[model samples]
Target: MTVAKTINRKLVKTITQRSLSTIAPQVRIYEVGPRDGLQNESKFVPTDIKIELINKIAAAGIKDIESASFVSPKWVKQMSDGVDVMKNLPRAPGVNYPVLVPNLKGYDTARQCNVEEVAIFPAGSEGFSQKNLNCSVEEGLKRFKLVADQAVKDGLRVRGYVSCVVGCPYDGPIHPKGIAKITEQLFEMGCYEVSLGDTIGVGTAGSVQRLMREVLTVAKPEQLALHFHDTYGQALSNLLAGLEYGIKTVDSSISGLGGCPYARGASGNLATEDLVYFLYGLGVNTHIDLVKLMEAGRYISNYLGKPTESKVNRALGDRFKNHNDIAKMASCDV
Candidate 1:
């Protein structure tokens, strides 16, 4: 037992060191604020506010933003105005706005809006696939494949999302091989990238490392992205684990504004402000302005009537207040 423990520790250390050694100089922050973030809001977010949010995110230097989803209004009321959100947002040059398309119907709507990219959501766990998507995993993938094929034929870029990659609320821990098989299928179906999502935020660094090791065998690290929720306060650490594996793209929401309506007890996503702050500290270039990003977070959080979930935002606000108070004291003495 002692020898086995020592070998395991050495293995983990070796993996960590190797991952850190090849960290990319820059990472792509795939902002999902306008789509995934707002989709779970109970109150209907006004179309204008959603548009303003996307514009602000773009202004803050997010190159890739998920503007909206073309899902049914009856199912996802918050995204009922997906078309309007895409049409009204002032399109910035060199910025790519992708939208979610659940099937051919949603894909057709997005294509009519001249969407450059579209994403399909498929779950890694059979239980989640049945519960959330209302279909078996195989059936869900079959549906996504049709959409992916059509999108690629229409000259649109396709991205794939595999939810519950780490563990599922309905089904316990997911097998890493399950995630790898699904990721491989998505890549085979012409998806430019596939994001592995810890939908319920039940993942830790060790789990993420183990999952990535398997998925990386089927898909290149560059073709994968990590989407983690902060329910367990381990999102950032899991993200760092992914980075060590050379995964360059990350999915995050501003103000941490997302939850799975179908997954009971699930929390919001990893806040964009927090992700940017961590990346900046690592000397990794995201080309995102932290102050501007927080401003956007504040804008959305105020609209939602909730305090920003980003710890970095709160800390920065306190720092600014302290500076202001010190300046006021000096002025009074003068």
Candidate 2:
């Protein structure tokens, strides 16, 4: 009788856990550290390290990784070796390595590398569109539409990014309607998915909820992804608000790398370690190997000669370090 009762309790616990996880389903983490995270480095990261860093992120179980950008060296000196990085990457099976292309020229250059997918970045704020692309938003979208059309004909998937969803440095406090309009156009432009970026990270949960309600009106939750920077410490909260509305995809960087070059006060993206830890706690399935992910974060942070910006990585790093120290001590003569 006692054994039967214990088995019955265990079965009930497993069923309850499964039910809890069904609230949001699986969360797909698109790792953007190699491209967005490292783009701002004043020092050029050697192509070798970039390749290894990307592979490490992939080994950590990230299905999608932004490998490089095909912009000119005059603009982003760090990504000057974009072609070599793409050509030499040991393109793993079952993983998507998408590169960012600024215009038809960049997209055509990326085509030579036989990339599987290409991502187009067009900011929602007119100020950013002029500053970043040196044109109005309408003109910029027209250019990207040509690129998207060509990419489709070439048999490559196109991903869209709408930056400055919540606020902008030059424009400031962008209305949700503008964001939705851009999202709607991108969806109609042959982009299988679009990632909305809170580039300056000034968004609150209330702001995120408001944006969610507006953006969802034009695009379904599954067709969109959230990219939030941690400048104001609200990235996690803003994500939670979006999650409440059933969005399951997020873009995060390892060790919290990346800052807006165009926006002065903005910061790095929300740390991958932080996001995965948060989701795991809520019983949401991320399918990421946290230990491997942390190792990858530590590798890049060490290479960059800086402490990591991830709070979760800092916490677990010490624990793992102490554990390793104890293991070493025990191996020595008692």
Candidate 3:
């Protein structure tokens, strides 16, 4: 159970670097396209297409994929067949496919699918709780505790999610104290890692820095991940801040095709293509193929009939065209 001290030391060192040098050399991207991205879709995506997207994400060399969530159909109709989606998806080698489970009922359904890893979400804001889960923050955590305990006994790896850590539509300016307390509860409940989410996409770098400063006091930076929405177009900026603080794990979507239903007009999670481009440009190692990843993003965006939210995808599209044109001219030279 011991991680080599050398590895841990190097990781900690990478996290301490300044924003200009903050790329973690080796970043872990948790792809949430199938679950977090699709959960907000008004149109129901076919199960077959969902499986295909998981395969495409895996093919793009993303090591962690949030495959689906086990929630009620009434709430998230697109993810109603989470168990079936898991059973049918192409299981790529060396990829961790984690599903989101809200409570013991969701966990029970996920376990029936033989899921080895699952994530539970507890809101950090009370107003968001009343609107989203129809319960108090404490009640949500109590339910999460039951699910977390049972999942551990069932030999499942649990990752926790804390939503609205920065701003809430119903309540503004959440304190770091509340975020830290909730995160501590998640970790205490046996979560292997806790992903702090800016569900409404209202966080700036300054806010994210403060939030991380508090959360890290209780949770190790290595055990934390950032899940940001780009509503204010500050996701990359905040991500930069996370890197500076030694947080190497991030959750993002391809083509940026999601938003929280509870918080309208939010730009959803940061785009995977954009995050990959940002890291790769800095010579940081993410191991994702930007060109292929863009293709994946483009494929999904095309299917959705929407222009991509990724700056990198649009730029790459232009570059791809130029590359093809140059190849044609070179053939003429021959």
User: Each model's TM-score?
Assistant: 0.90, 0.89, 0.89
* Per-residue lDDT of model 3, residues 246-279, tens digit only: 8889999988868988886777789998887677
Clashes of each: 0, 0, 1
- Model 2: worst 10 consecutive residues (lDDT sum): 321-330
lDDT for model 2: 0.89
RMSD of 1: 6.6
lDDT of 1 by residue, 1-334 (tens): 6999999999999976676677788999999989999999997899999988888999889999999999999889999998888888889999999999999999989987889999999999999999888999999999999999999999999999999998998899999999999999999999999999999999999999999999999988899999999999999999998998899999999999898887788889999988887876666778877777788989999988989988878777534433223333323534
Candidate 3 residue runs with Cα over 4 Å from true position: 1-23, 321-334
| Model 2 pairs whose backbones collide | none
The CA lDDT at 156 in model 2 is: 95
Error of 1 at 4 (Å): 26
lDDT of each: 0.89, 0.89, 0.85
